[model samples]
Target chain A: MTVLEARDVSYQYSVGTPFQITALEHISFSVEKGELLAIIGHTGSGKSTLIQHFNALLKPTSGQILLYGKDINETKETARDARFKVGLCFQYPEYQLFESTVYKDIAFGPGNMGLSKEEIDARVRRAAAFVGLTEPMLEKSPFDLSGGEKRRVAIAGVMAMEPEVLIMDEPAAGLDPRGRRKILEMIENYRRQTGSTVIIVSHSMEDVASLAERILVLNHGKIARMGTVDEVFSHAEELQNMGLNIPQLTGIFTRLNQLGYGVNPLTYTVEQAKTEILRYLHKGGAADG
Target chain B: MENDSLIKFNDVSYRYESDTDTPLPLAIKNIDLDIRKGEFVAVLGHNGSGKSTLAKLANAILAPESGKIFVNGMDTSDESLEYEIRQTVGVVFQNPDNQIVATIVEEDVAFGPENLGIEPKEIRRRVDDALKSVGMYEYRFHEPHKLSGGQKQRVAIAGIMAMQTECIILDEPTAMLDPKGREEVMKAMQRLNKELGVTIVLITHYMDEAVKADRVIVMDSGRIVLDGTPRQVFAEEETIEKAGLELPDCAKLAHALKRSGVNMPSDILTPDEFVEAFQRCVSGGGVL
Candidate 1:
């Protein structure tokens, strides 16, 4: 089922002025329920603006945004409903964490929905648990925690909303290897437990390859490509030409495939690369070497 | 004091004071290290591993509580030499916007030298040279806020260059940038380090960036756990993991291949190096 859809979306940044600019032109895509999608592009690729349109945070200057077959902007109430149904998380977790305590910060979103007091408490606890936050952490100031922990609190705030679709921007930005891995795992586990559609915007091609089921590549505010992992990453040159990157490790295998080694070059993860390289070497791939 | 050393740390230790009764652990503990002149050294560690603290200690931004740090053989603890120490060892932090002051790019670069009371004519020359070095000369007249993250970061580096600092310490300068921005900033750093003979101490979590350095330092629990050339340090795959870091993608692949009885080298850090090693191994050459 399509949880969100963008039909012929076009947006202008500065309308009717000398500096008028079209940020998005004829953009069209539909997000399926329970799918993990990643939108990738350079800094000015209209990714943020495009995601804003999904949640009705910004209405398209032309065209319609649909949530479950209904236009999100059909009425003010529906627009507000789309916002609650699609959770959009911005980068820099600290900016989103303003409440005094971690618990309050997590509770703020659910509280805004006018849920029952007990229901809100239950959702807050569940969200905190989903993000791996401890019991004592709830009483402390979110600002006082470590960077990783602060980010968890911010994630919990969004997860507490229990949106049908969870969208995060650069969820693992600025984290070390362990922390980065943890965020990716948390994103995965959250999707598994909740069965919610997940969308993330990222710059790390490696992370996107590992986590995302589908990739949406944007360049100059237009969709350059949208496909499965293999479909998108297969065209490394095109992606690279658009100021993007592929996993360097994958590049090696891909280059070998191009050189007639006949090795499977579609894999990006380490486990798959190891198997493919081992298979090639064992099969007397030594001649071309 | 070693004559070739630009920044030397001798048994240095520092801990932040806590306002509450709870005592805080040392941010950087008993670190004895030396960065020689004109060397590109990259420091890697997880958050709170004292990499930033070490950078701060080098520039006299934070005084060591136990030992001493010398920039050009001048003690960092000395109050009178603070200005001189900072002048010699400049720092570019992770967020470029925080360090940039002026609206225009050239003015932001000139802010450093201008504050030092340099004449306008000389300042203009220094500013232009610095901007050109970072490949941001064309953007010099543009507003600093309008430039991309990588461009803004290069402008910040130009600011330090205008001061003519002999050494620079950068703390995850590319952490917030995209791939292209990261490439731009990394290129500028390399150009400055190689062309101008400026010593570079970069604190980063990116393994690929660390591989380009002359030396790689790994810190853990406020101590230097590993220190060697990129090849030497990355060879210790187990130690890197214990330090809360991971091997570069190629290195990890090599390790996996070796575990599966393939003859790939365990120290491959980059994709090109991996491709080269894989070819040699497949050619039935002796294990390297």
Candidate 2:
């Protein structure tokens, strides 16, 4: 089932002003329930502008957004419901964290929903646990925590709402490899447990290659391409020309194929590359150099 | 005292003092390092690992509590030489929004040199030169707020370059930027190092970025745990793991291929190298 759909969406910044600029134009895509979709684009490529329309954060200047077959902006109640059903975790969300303590910060979203105190407490604890925050950490000032910890707390704030469709922009950005792995794993676990649709806006081709079931490529306020991970990444030259990158491993395989190596050009991960190389060697390839 | 050393840290240590009930941990402790002239040094560490503190110490924004720092020929601890030291060492912080002060692009790039009391004519020359160096000369008339994150970051770097600082230290300058912006900033750094001969000290969490540096330094628990060329440092998997880091994609794949009884070279740090090595092995009859 389609969880969210953008029907010919178009957005303009500062419309009617002298500096008005088109950020997204005639973009159309539908996100399925329980699917992990990765949106890849260069800077100023309309990835952020497009996602904002999903939760009614920014109404389109020309088109419409539908959540579960209902127009989000059709009425006030529908728009509000769309906001609750589609949670957005912005880039550098840690900066938005404002409560005195981590617990209070995570509780902010649920509290605004008018949930009972006991229900709020349970949701907050579960969300914190999903992000690997310990009980003692919830009591400490969010300011005193490490940068990675503070980012997790910010993500937990969104998770506490238990939205059916969670969208995170650049979720693993600015993290070391280990930290990136932990955060991505946390996101995966959350998706599995909740069976919620996950959409991530990312610049890392490697992260998208590994995690995303389908990928969307945006360029200059337009949908350049949208397909499965393999399908999108197969067009390496097109992505490079658009100022976007393919996974590093894919680049290598593409080069190898160009050089008459005849290797599998669709390889995106390390395991696949390793297996392909081994298979080539077993088929009478030499090691005499 | 080394003649070639542009910056030196002699047993540096720093700890933040907080009045809150919760105690703050030491920011950096017992560190010693030397950055030679015209070298590109990349610093890698997890958050709270004292990497930012190290950047602050380089330009005398934060003095060492128990050690000493020298920029070029001036001691950072000397009050009389503070201006000279700051002029010699420029720092570009993580957040581009915070560092940009001017509404217009050219004006922001001129902020640093103007503060040095340079004449207006000289400031104009420096501003034009800096903007062109970062490929932002076309946007010089544009408003800083209207520019993308990458464009704004380039403006920030140009601001530092206009000051004619001998060395530039960036504290996770690309942390908040998208991939394209990150690439733009990295290319600018490379140009500054290669064409202008300016020393660069980059602090980043991305291993791929670190691989492009002339040298990589890994810090943990407020101390330098690993320091070597990118190839040498990334070759040690155990050390990287202990320091809360990981090998680049190429290096990890090479290691795994080697373990799987494929003839893969161990020093592969990039995809190009990996492809070349694999082609050689396949044609030369390497054991499977």
Q: Which model scores highest in TM-score?
A: 2
- DockQ of predicted model 2: 0.64
Q: How close to the true structure is residue A250 of candidate 1, measured as C-alpha lDDT? A: 76
Q: TM-score, each model?
A: 0.94, 0.96
Lowest lDDT 10-residue stretch of candidate 2 chain B: B279-288
lDDT of each: 0.88, 0.89
lDDT of 1 at A131: 84
Candidate 2 ranges beyond 4 A from true positions:
A285-289, B20-23
Q: How much is A284 displaced in model 2, in angstroms?
A: 3.2
Interface RMSD of each: 2.4, 2.4
DockQ, each predicted model:
0.55, 0.64
Docking class of 2: medium
The alpha-carbon deviation from the true structure for residue A15 of candidate 2, after best TM-score superposition, in angstroms, is 1.9
Query: What lDDT score is found at residue A194 in candidate 2?
Result: 90
Summarize candidate 2's per-residue lDDT along A207-253 as a digit string, tens digits: 89999999999999999999999899999889988888788888888
